[model samples]
Target: MTNRNIKAIKWFINTQLLGKWYNVAYATFKVTSKCNLKCTFCNPAYYSGTLEEGSTERLKKVIDNLRDSSVVVLSFEGGEPTTRPDILDLLGYAHDGSFYVMLTTNGYRLGDPSFLSKISERIDFLHYSIDEYHWNLKALDNLCKFREFGLKVNVQTVVTRYNINTLEDKVKKVRECGYKILLMPAVDYPDSKVKLEPDKEQFYQVLSYLKGKYGSTLNNSWGFIRALKGEFPKRLTSYAITIYPNGDLPYPDDINGEVIGNLSQNKLGELLNSYRAKELRRKMMENSARYEYLHLQTASFNSIKDLAEYAREMGKWAFTGKA
Candidate 1:
């Protein structure tokens, strides 16, 4: 059997039989915070902090730490991972077949055929961010080109008020191009002057329309789509964890809370099962209906001040139905 298949089997055993609830199914690591373009909907620095990046040696350590965990799929993200000089080396180090290694890119460096030729071999798939906000609408033309390079591709489009009206058309385009697309709502950071979130009714309408018309082409599960629309009845199973560039665990299993532990200083298992993590998980299990709190952490809030503000808003909306 292939190494990946073996890993998949092991993951199944660990999460199912062993009941390793903290076994992360998806892990996203930000390799760098430096980007070639500044986006309105997203401030790349908002998540990763300053423009500095993790070095090859540091990244290798992070990868090793992740390998020791129950991470089945690892996706390298960034301000733009392509901006790093040693990204190819990093990708090669993680592409040892233990886990599916994916890269999320802005596609600025993808225009060069030679670059793609080199990096394509190291990563399993490429998630290209193509949306109106990035000013890279032409990126749609390169979907087939990525397929030609033998690289599996998925388009990640951030939905906002500006593009809500045209999302159905974009879904059609993605389907026509024969690639899957994951639609995520635009997160209005606590500090941003402009809140780009689409109107709640409009957001729900778009997601419902896309979920119905393009279910096959959409990457989000029905539960996730509903959760996005604030319809959280049951606890959403969160298997995705994000590690910041500095080795801090933002939210293990996407539950918002304090940094569990720095991978550089601690083992993944120890941190995931730490008292703090267990408490967070317990709180989530007990009050899984309040998905808004769970989601605020996933939306890239960097400070407690902002998180608290949003939490108040969520409470207001949830209790009094007024925001």
Candidate 2:
């Protein structure tokens, strides 16, 4: 088996078979918080360019820490990850490591052929954050174009109270292009007053309908769909963790919890096992009903069906470069 496959298998055995829920399987590294667009539903801190990005060397150290923690997947997110000057360097570094690297972008920088060409080889998947919120309605028109660069593209659409009905059309567009789309609800951050979160009943109904019609093209497990309806008890928070630009880990998650420690100062495995992390995990479990973050909620795969669905979607993407 390839090194990436071996790492994935090891992670699966550690987390799934051994029941080591704290062993992280995925890491979302926010490379920068300087986005070009001002989406109303997005967290201001994420796009305000206020967070100080660490130097490339420091970020590499953070990646090394995640690798040591046995994280199987590392997704580079941001205000806009492409906004960073050394993004290619970081992506290439992570790609060379054991983690399967992915980049999430708004596609603004992707218009530059040179930049697109450079990033395509350094990452396994390109998660395109497209929606009316990003002001990229016509972005779906160019989905197939990235295939020419040999980049596997996945659409990530924000399902808000205003845009829930339009999701079926987006799924259709993605399916036509032989791509998959992961739809998530717009979260109301503690710092923001705007309530863009969709109604639970309506959101679940719409997602269920889309999943039934579109199959793997929808890219959401039934468990995740059920979790959207306030069924939040089975959350797997530690399965995926988020890291800030300067290497701070928002233990459990950024939305409902506090920073446990800085990855730059401590190893990820050690930090996750610290007292603060344990206390926060207990608190998060006690108040799980109120948590609505998509990343954390989706990690709560309560049934075998969920795991099977995820495996099938990932298998197709890994082998065929399509989903």
Q: For this target, which candidate reaches the highest lDDT against the unseen true structure?
A: 2
For candidate 2, write residues 206-291 as lDDT tens digits: 98898888888887777777777765525455477889999989878877778878887799889887888889888877776666
Give the CA lDDT, 0 to 100, for residue 215 in model 2.
85
| Residue lDDT tens for model 1, 277-311 | 87887776566544432242333222334324434
Poorest 10 consecutive residues by lDDT, candidate 2: 294-303
Displacement of the residue 198 alpha carbon in candidate 1, Å: 2.2
Top TM-score prediction, candidate number: 2
Name the Cα RMSD for model 1.
10.0
TM-score of 2: 0.95
Candidate 2: regions farther than 4 A off: 231-237, 292-298
Which consecutive 10 residues in model 1 have the weakest lDDT in total? 293-302
Alpha-carbon runs more than 4 Å astray in model 1? 44-52, 229-233, 253-255, 283-323
